[model samples]
Target chain A: MRLVQGNEAVVLGALAGGCNFYAGYPITPATEIMEQMARVLPARGGVFIQMEDELAALGAVIGAAWGGMRAMTATSGPGFSLMQEHIGYAAMTQTPCVIVDSQRVGPSTGQPTMPAQGDVMQARWGSHGDRPAIVVTASSVKDAYQMTQLSFEWADTYRLPVIVLLDAVLSHMRENVELPPAPPPFSRTLSPDVDVEKPFGNHPFVPFAETTRTIVTGLAHDETGATRGTVGHASEKIIRDAFNRLNHDYAAITQYREYRLEDAAWAVVSYGITARAARAAVDILRGEGMRVGLLELISLWPFPEPTVQSLARQVQGILMPELNLGQLILPLRAAVEGICPVAGLGRADGELFTPEEIANAMTSHSTHAERRVSHHA
Target chain B: MPKMGEDLHQYLRQQMMPTVWCPGCGHGNIARAIATALEHLGTDLGQVAILGGIGCSGRTPFYFNTNAMHTTHGRVLAFATGLKLANPRLTVITAMGDGDALAIGAGHFIHAARRNIDLTVILYNNSIYGMTGGQQAPTTPFNFRSTTSPFGNIEPTFDTVDLALAAGATYVARTTTFDFAEMPEYILGAIRHPGFAVVEILSQCPTYFGRLNKLGDPPDMLEYERNHTIVADEESVISRDELLGNLPVGVFRQEIRPEYTHQYADLCQARGGAYRA
Candidate 1:
């Protein structure tokens, strides 16, 4: 156990997760991740590269992954936007790599120094085309440490780019984080029956390598890694299979925590730094005997629909407090499907929501719900 | 039964026959030159990785039997950089079209040269975006007409060989597809060079650059290259303008520099860290 910043925790977590190659361009809130990697990765016999831009950073990470190395890149909003094209490529090629997006306020480089959950939607759908995205958000230094390690495992297991979305506040904030004992370095399992001449034999998780002679391309390819562009059902089958691989393992991929949800009527749904305040708000509301609980989302994509649906049946209303203007609430509403009313308490002025604010929102939301029910009756 | 180079079947993926290049496209010649160069060098096919950017030239990697990756448009070199750095033993060769190499991917081109990474860049300079239906490319000759430049092009063209040399490519050479016999030797030289090597092949795009510019058939373009190009010698100093116009063909620069991967490994070892083999 040691005190560490969120960005520092990411570095420690990545090392523990067996990341051997890191390529990145220095951007604020994420530069420390690159700097730390540069200082430590080489000593650990790993490769650390400061690429010319974020495009090259992700591009290199994809190539390193194919070259039989666990690789990653870190960048903030503008840099993250630049990486979207290759992120699609990584997704298409089924490349196992981690992309750490320490998000700041942006449509374009809006506050770089302040915290915002602006990239939640971007992390899910920033890349073009229909593709499966595995995005996880971290709320504290501990979650940052553990989630970064889990991000690699998810990426390797699924053979796709896994995004660790960290907001500016959590990224810069420091706290005492207990680092777990490092696990054995994880490598993608190659099939024993894989033909050297034609690798990628029937296994979806197999990574490309020099020995494999596998041709990794952005064009839709079959299990053998050959380009099959809309020719038959092959392209469609491959894309569907890529999605199915994640969908089939939804139980393992979806991660979240319920704080005081049992016997609660109102819930605050939040993620990243906003979740920190939500947790506190849950405590404050519970102290007042308001029966308010919190649903802290750890996995942002695959949306934790089942859990949200179940929670919807238990709660009268849900208040989603986020740093951005109600991105996660939209999906939460769909998941709840009007069984329970969902309200968004969003702020994008580079300020985090306080416990008092969240507690007030929860009170107001439940009051409105009660009034609406009485009026209908 | 295969065609004339049936013996070279070992280097090619026989199943991926009937390539996407148009008839008389110089990309085929460039691809053949690559195959010949690897054969000449007796390079272990398994130890080679052919990377290609998106374009007509980007499809080159699919024909090869080695570890290949047809990457996104204008990003093959970036991918190759990572692959080479991760496993320095693999001989990395990148193929990119004129626009792929110089237009969108120009930043990577210059930076890769500056880093002096050991990769052979086979730039197929066709002067037009052949794959995307005859758009003007970075290497499109001044006043050359294309789909985008239907009127005469007002933009000045890039002398890629000069650009490569200026950007610190340790080995820089230019050859036309017409010089088929000599093209392989230049490619072989690039492959053998220990630092960043660029072999720009002046490939003719008969379907696009040729027809739009009224340069006749593929043979006519080849004739134009033969007539206009002058081989630079030690005795004469060729001006940039003349070199650009006449397409000065030959090895323009060669230097020894510390290769990036080797230096990185040495740095790690010097720091008492185990260098990744």
Candidate 2:
């Protein structure tokens, strides 16, 4: 175990997980990831390229992936925004890659160095088309390492872009992280001879076990890679099957951690750095003889909805404290479906939520009962 | 150029054609020229990767039998950079239009030239956006009419050869469909040149640029190119032709440099890393 910053841990994990190619442009809170990658990649038989911008960064990552390298890029909010088009292209062409968005407060660079969970929705809907995204949030330095490696595994497995969301604070904070023993269970090492994957085949984009005439494009093309232009049969199948592939296997992709929730009357749902406070709050509430527990979300998209639904049936209410003005709560409420009251505690002041702050909210909600306000509509 | 006749079918994807280029379009001529160039090189066709941006030129990838990727507009060079570095053995080529290379993707273009990566870039300079129904392009002649520039374009044209040379391209050439017979010599030189190589083919968009500027029919445009252009044997494209309002057509720059991918492999080796690329 070594004490490493969140960004440093990401590089350690990505390299350990066999990311052979990295392309990036510097942005605040995420520059360390790129800087470290450049320093270490070349020395370790990996390639690191400093691209012109975030658009070219992700573009190069996709190109490298097709060139049979496990590729990735690091960015914050503004850079993440620039990568949306390529994200859609990766989806359309079914390229396997990882994009780590160390999010900061932003409409356009609102608070460059401050942490904000404002990108929660954009991570899912940033691209133009209807495509499913696998987003995993990191609550600590170690989680950052695990989630970054896990993003690569799931990207290769699902044949789509997997985004790992880390906030400014979590990205910089250091911790004694014990690297996962033996790389995330499913991490893949591509062979040297693999040039391209058969994009439309049953086993898609997995380091070309067989050369299948790689003709990848962002356009809606048939199996032979000819442009269909209209959303005809090929486009129709692509769009229609986009969600089903991930949703049906939701159990496998969705990963989370539950803390002290058995026989609890209330549950606080939070993720990333906010979960640290929520965990302390749950401990504080339980010490005061209140049955409150914490459900720390690790994966943001392909959300653990069934688990949230089961918690709703078990608890009287759910209180969610977030770093933004309530983004993930939309899907949480959809999962809860009015089974219980769901309230939100949002902080966008570029500060972490204190344990007392979240504990008091849960205490007040448990007593007032009439103060139940959930965006059920 | 060895018989671009029925034998050239080995280099093409027969089913995807009839190309999306218009009737009497010069993009097809350039595509055939590239095929003959690849055919002449006689390398394993599977080892080549043809990439294109979003335009009439972008569709060229679908017609090649090699490993192909149709990338985003103006960003194919950036993609090719990563691709070539990833697998240095793969001979990479990118085809882009004026708007794709100069207007939107200008940054990537100069940087690719600056790095001098081992990739052959073909610019089908049609002077208008043919796929998007003829908008004013960066290569569009000064005050030449286009659909977007209905009142006649006031913007100055980007001299394709000068731009390539200034941007540090080691091997740069400008040819037109009118000079089709000589096109393969420059293309073959580009493919073998061991660094960033650019061949800017002044292709005809008879359907768009021809119509907007009243440049007569496709044959008339090709004939016009033959009449107006001078064979460039001088140090600079503008040395003698600038006075005649004529563009130069020939291989203008050919120099040697350490290709990006080769240097990357050397770096990996020097660092005692396991990278064999």
Candidate 3:
């Protein structure tokens, strides 16, 4: 239990989740994470390196992870863009690690120190191909701490890269947060020894000639870590198995918080910094006797899909507010299948949504709300 | 020479053979020098890891029986830095060609040397892009003929040893493939040196550099390297005009510097638990 800034919470969460090595090159709004980690990690018998650039930072984190250390790196929008290729490599290699993106506005080094959640879609599909990842967002300082802790756990649990998506608002905002005294839950698995000499045996999932140990390289492999070209059953199995871990066992990785949903006919599902505003707005609506619920998503990817779908079926509509041009709303609409009309409230003006602004939208006597509730019922 | 009395070819065949370099290339000689150096040092094969970048020289990891990685182009140093910091037990070595080390990875090369990272960089300089056609490279020597520089190169070449010394490499050495015996000693010394050792091997690329410049066959290129290169000395003086013809070769510098990882560990020790306190 402590009063801390959102950036401080993220740093504490990283330490609590057993991140022992941090390789980062400083970028604005994200510099606090690096500064805090530099101070905190060393005290906990960890390592911190300020790399020459974003590429080396990412490269070092990946190497450190392979060297059997829980590692991490932090960046903002521009630096995050620079890290996409290595992020893809981490996904393909199934390297367990975490990355924190304190997003700022950008196409090319846009507002360096200002807040914007413009990277919502980029976080999901930044890297090449269909590599699924676990993305969590922090709305407040407390969420920053808890969600970052969750990020590392999810990364290590599934042997995949986890992204802690923080916009400048939440990343720089200060608030009181009650952190759990003890460390959070996590599990790090060891590679099953398959005898390096025999390399690939008669394994069903992995193919022949692939190395026995985890190769940890970006090259395509047949599960045994041997480089295999894109062809045949090996390719199919690799893709299928990787996605199975993402889609099927994905439910176990989801984290979210629902507020005042009983008998609600409309919901505002949001993530990152905007969720704080959404929660405040939902409370005002609830006080005014409006049956509005807020689903504050903690896990941004493996996106509280089942819970969102269930709520969309029962609710008349969903209002998703974000800092970007409605990146999360598109996915919500896709999952809801028009069972509910999804309305988007987005502003990329480097300003956060005010509680008054969000409440006005929710409690408006819009005729569409009346028609939607009646039609759904 | 007597201490290492075994035949180089036989020793190579027994310990590391079936070379991974492309046929008709000079990388085999570079590989031979590296292997010979390790043999000279009595370095255990199990404890060494050859971290390689993407290039012709990057394939050096495949021929060696040591633990190694064929990392992405221009990123071997980053990976090697992590490996050395994590274990501090493995002898991490990076092998990269001219373009791989100097062009795409120039930033990393400079920083690695400046920080005095504990690793060895075996920079193979053949003065032309060999793997992806004979393109103009940072080390493609001024006015050298190549596919990209068909009319002749306008950019001046990088003297890798000089660049490394300027960038703070604790040990810096330059040797041509023609000086096989001395080349091995340079490699050995670079590997055993305290921090950020760089041994730039002036290699021959008969197919690319040789064919383009009409340096004749591989033997002629080797003979040219032997005759034209000078052993650098304290009193040695050459005019800028004379420098165009002669490339100095030999151990140019060696000094002990505290490595980045060790210094970082010491920082951790000094900060104590009061870091958070």
In lDDT terms, which candidate is top? 1
DockQ of model 1 vs. true complex: 0.70
With a 3 Å backbone cut-off (N, CA, C), the pairs that clash in candidate 3 are A210-A226, A211-A226
lDDT of 2 by residue, B1-277 (tens): 4455457888898867788889989999998988888888888876888999889999899898888889999999888888887778888889999899999999989988988888899999999999999999998888889998998899998887888899899999988988877777778889999999999988888999998899999999999888878776456446543647878788888989887877888887888766665
Better of 2 and 3 by TM-score: 2
lDDT of 1 by residue, A1-377 (tens): 67799999998899888898999999987889999999887776788888888999999998888778899999999999999999999888888899999988877889999989999999889999887889999988989888899998888777789999998888888997678765554455667666665333225454455466678788766667666455346756766777888889898888898899888988888888988899999999999999888889999898899999989999889999988887988888988886999889988888888999999999999999999999999
TM agreement with the true structure for every prediction: 0.96, 0.94, 0.89
**Per-model DockQ:** 0.70, 0.64, 0.33
Chain A TM-score values, per prediction? 0.95, 0.91, 0.88
CA lDDT, every prediction?
Answer: 0.86, 0.85, 0.77
Tell me, by DockQ, which candidate is best: 1
Tens digits of lDDT, candidate 3, B1-277: 4133355543332323465555657788878777887877776665677778877888777566565666777887887777676556667778999998999988889999999988999999888888887899999877889999999999988879879989999888888888778777888888888799999988888888999999998889999888878876334676666666788877777878788877877787787722110
lDDT of 2 by residue, A247-348 (tens): 888998888889999989899999999999999999999999999899999998988888999999999889999999989999999889779878899988
Candidate 2 deviates by what RMSD? 3.1
Best by TM-score: 1
Off by over 4 Å in 2: A180-198, A206-211, A228-231, A368-377, B1-6, B233-242
Docking class of 2: medium
Q: Which 10-residue span in candidate 1 chain B carries the lowest summed lDDT?
A: B1-10
